[model samples]
Target: MRNSRRNFLQQLAVSAAAMPFLTFEQQAYTPVPHNRQGRVLRVALMGLGGYATRVAEAMQSCKRAKITGLISGTPAKIKEWQAKYNIPEKNCYNYETFDQVKDNPDIDAVYVITPNGLHHDQVIRIARAGKHVICEKPMAINAREGQEMVDACREAGVKLLVGYRMHFEPNTLEVIRMRSAGEFGKIMFFQGLSGFKIGDPTQWRLDKTLAGGGAMMDIGIYSINGSRYMVGEDPIWVTAQETKTDEVKFKAGVDETIQFQLGFPGGAVASCLSTYNMNYLDRFFMTGEKGFVEMQPSTGYGPIKGRTHQGALAQPHVMHQTLQMDGMAEIILDDSQPVVPVDGLEGLKDLKIIDAIYAACATGQRQKLSL
Candidate 1:
């Protein structure tokens, strides 16, 4: 055993010597500036699912970014996107060959839109490829995995951004601005309800192993996120109750509905419900000492509308996803911070809350957040 350990150490030392030293200057990862003068950011889409397709369209409208590479498991989908996006045949890559993308100077970043379970591996791989990463929501199965991805990106000197569309929406941003500007006096409470009747039993969303959890992991995340933004602070503690309507339907790890409450730092409280057994009621309501702000159907695909106690907001009139993509491009290229918080840290906070929620549900007791 001693000899084997020594051999392993010697091999590791030799490998370390073979690798180039990473200096402080070499460690700096410069973002592409938003100006039109520089080269356009060449992005690669790692998954060709529905969300990936929508992101591709949004990228087309970005003046500073474009899809230059495609990675997909399905050969048919690869051929289709290659033709649609005018991606060169040489730039197309399968799952096995995706690591080779590190050598392709044309690809500066990668977007991972795979299933929830696949996010951790894909993000780590992309970060190792020395490319910036944009990942779909939930970030990972849990906070631990999310932190791993973040650490990997930081170590690789790459930028990591989560796909949080509402952070970039005009109406949502206005609400945040109003709250921060004291339009709403001394915020008091927040209420969020996000649910959808998921009909497909065979869908990956219903599978516990693939999805990590049920409605909470899927549509329920919107509630978790809405509460954080609406309250304008991370929750100090969480209490939750869960109900499984049909064990046969929801399965062992699947939850049909969950009611969770959050206690914020400044004596604020948020009540939220997330489910897969109900109709769409995605909304966010925040009440302050002055009045209230409400967003009906807040966390959906497009055309999110809202009004504050002051009055109706002036809509920017664009797809929420589109705005998010453009904003991400600006952050990557222009070194801009999002007006509303949507960084990896923000996403990680949400995941921490999620961890608490799951624990509360299991124990039937309130759980305090450590961070």
Candidate 2:
């Protein structure tokens, strides 16, 4: 009798599960609220560096997005990109002619993938051209410039989004969701490590005027952002220690590596290390009362691996930048919010934390976060 009862209960459970699948059409056909059926977003590439090349490739996969404009100082690069992307001469602009892009009706947005120090001026120029702006990470050389960029976009009535690729990545999003849903219970501590052995001391990345502070500004920002997203909270205070193994390689104005700690409101702590002197070791680990989640290669360019207390996620993969561009398109054209957080406010918060970390490093004292 017990065996028969168990069999009946199993069948009942299966039926219950099948009911949702059988009625899936009822849910599947629900129309999207934004009604962006035929709209297409036309984008402009403002820089032609390695990152810009990657960004251009990513835009190819966006259903409602296309690269319609090209802006480069080099005629060779402009001609090459125009030919490769099939962009017309009418949509291409050099630094001298870029000011005229405001009159060009073909472009709706301009992506600034230039060095960190160049972000402020380029963003302002793009905003003045009446186009939305998408800027690479660390938004600017400092928080003040970041604020100015935000203000310029607001004044121009065009949207501004920071290129935070992880926010649109599936594995990172999964970790964020798990944390938000309380799957990890009361969060206690987190750890993040982001590093890459930077070569070519003469590269733009080592130039203080072009790349800003150093490893912290370029790749260390990832550690700052990852802890914030995974913890799902703004930090209340920060403490940091800066180190430089090769003074000649790092130079005077740039940092080689930095180890930092952030204190959250509920006593949660995050310890992070950012270095340009080490081999690649991008990872994030979050521990809480109930369980924990870990991601290896957490902040690389693409194809982030994710696992949780539930299990490994299975889906056909895409480039992280491609997914981010697609999601940005949806947000711009379809009025859809990003599944992962990637808004101006989120970018500003990360900058605020970064400012505190810098202050702590310089003062050799714990800095209290203002926001």
Candidate 3:
């Protein structure tokens, strides 16, 4: 038994020495300005999917963020991004070869824009490589996977940021500011409707294995996340009802539409809907004692229209992805925290609520959420 333990320790020591960045170097890392110029946070795109393409294009408008590396399973896609983004061959990687990214100095972080189910493994791999990770919404299939990803990144001394783009939007932040400033005068209720007519019935998003759930996992998460931020409190209980209009399209285990009610500790209540069959139905409404705030097309890609009982929100419009990348760059390189957090724990809270909502729907009872 002693010999076995000694051998295991020796192997662990060898692995640690092999991966130098896995040391306590990240703990000692302080936000150092590169020069008189702004800090640069070099990022690598892991998946070359549609969302990844959008993020790469928007990253061009970011001052402190640069696409310095590419990681994709497709060789042709990697070649295209390398040429288009001016990424050197050495900085490019495939999924199987991505672990070697720790040896490269130019890449500072990996953005995991893969499917919902793939986030857990890919994010852990990025942390093991000693790089920060920015995973897209629905951080993982469930809270268990999400927590594991969080623990992996924490152990690695790396940051795990979720791609909650709405958290960085100017108008949304303004509304949050108003609520914090007592403009809302004690929040009471919030309503979030997030859904779209999903295309391609055969896509992986409809697959339970890859997506973990149906419409709720894909677009419904926006409503869940929005409610938490708008209410400024975590939910204590959830009661949900799910409906499926098209069994063939949505599948048995997946949800086509779900209406959920969340009860908060401060007596605030949130009613939300997540669906795939609905069209042009992205909106959020928050009503308080003093006033109310409403946003139409709230979670869309751009030009989020919003207004309160006070007046029109005159906040300037910027691309959501652009603002999100720039804000994330500051968080990474400057050690700055955003007015609205987009960290892994923040993502975990949403996932936990999702788990409870699913349970509530299954049992036809109000589910308790300890988050």
Which one wins on TM-score?
Answer: 3
Comparison by lDDT, 2 against 3, better one = 3
In candidate 1, how many Å is residue 339 off?
1.9
Pairs that collide, model 3: none
Query: Each candidate: what lDDT?
Result: 0.80, 0.79, 0.86
Candidate 3 residue spans exceeding 4 A from truth: 1-38
As a TM-score, model 2 comes out at 0.89
For candidate 3, the per-residue lDDT at 356 reads 93
What are the per-residue Cα lDDT tens digits for candidate 3 across 1-371? 23433343344445544565531111111223432255678999988999999999998988778899999999999988888999999999998999998999999999998889899999999999999999998999999999999999999999999999998787886777667557899889999999989999889999998899998898999989898878777889999999988999988778899999999888999999999998988999999999999999788986888889989876778778888888888887777656567899989999999999999999999998987
**Residue lDDT tens for model 1, 1-371:** 23433343344345445657531111112223455467567889988988888888877777677899999999999999999999998888988899888899889888888888898998999899899998888898899999999899999999999989887776775676566556788889999999988897889988987888899988889988877776677778999999887888899888899999988888989999999988967889999998799988698876777788778766666766667776777777676555445667767877888888999999998899965
TM-score of 1: 0.89
How far residue 9's Cα lies from its native spot in candidate 1, in Å, is 53
- Model 2 whole-model lDDT (C-alpha atoms): 0.79
C-alpha TM-score for every candidate: 0.89, 0.89, 0.90
Q: Candidate 1 overall Cα lDDT vs. reference?
A: 0.80
Cα RMSD (Å) between model 1 and the true structure? 12.5
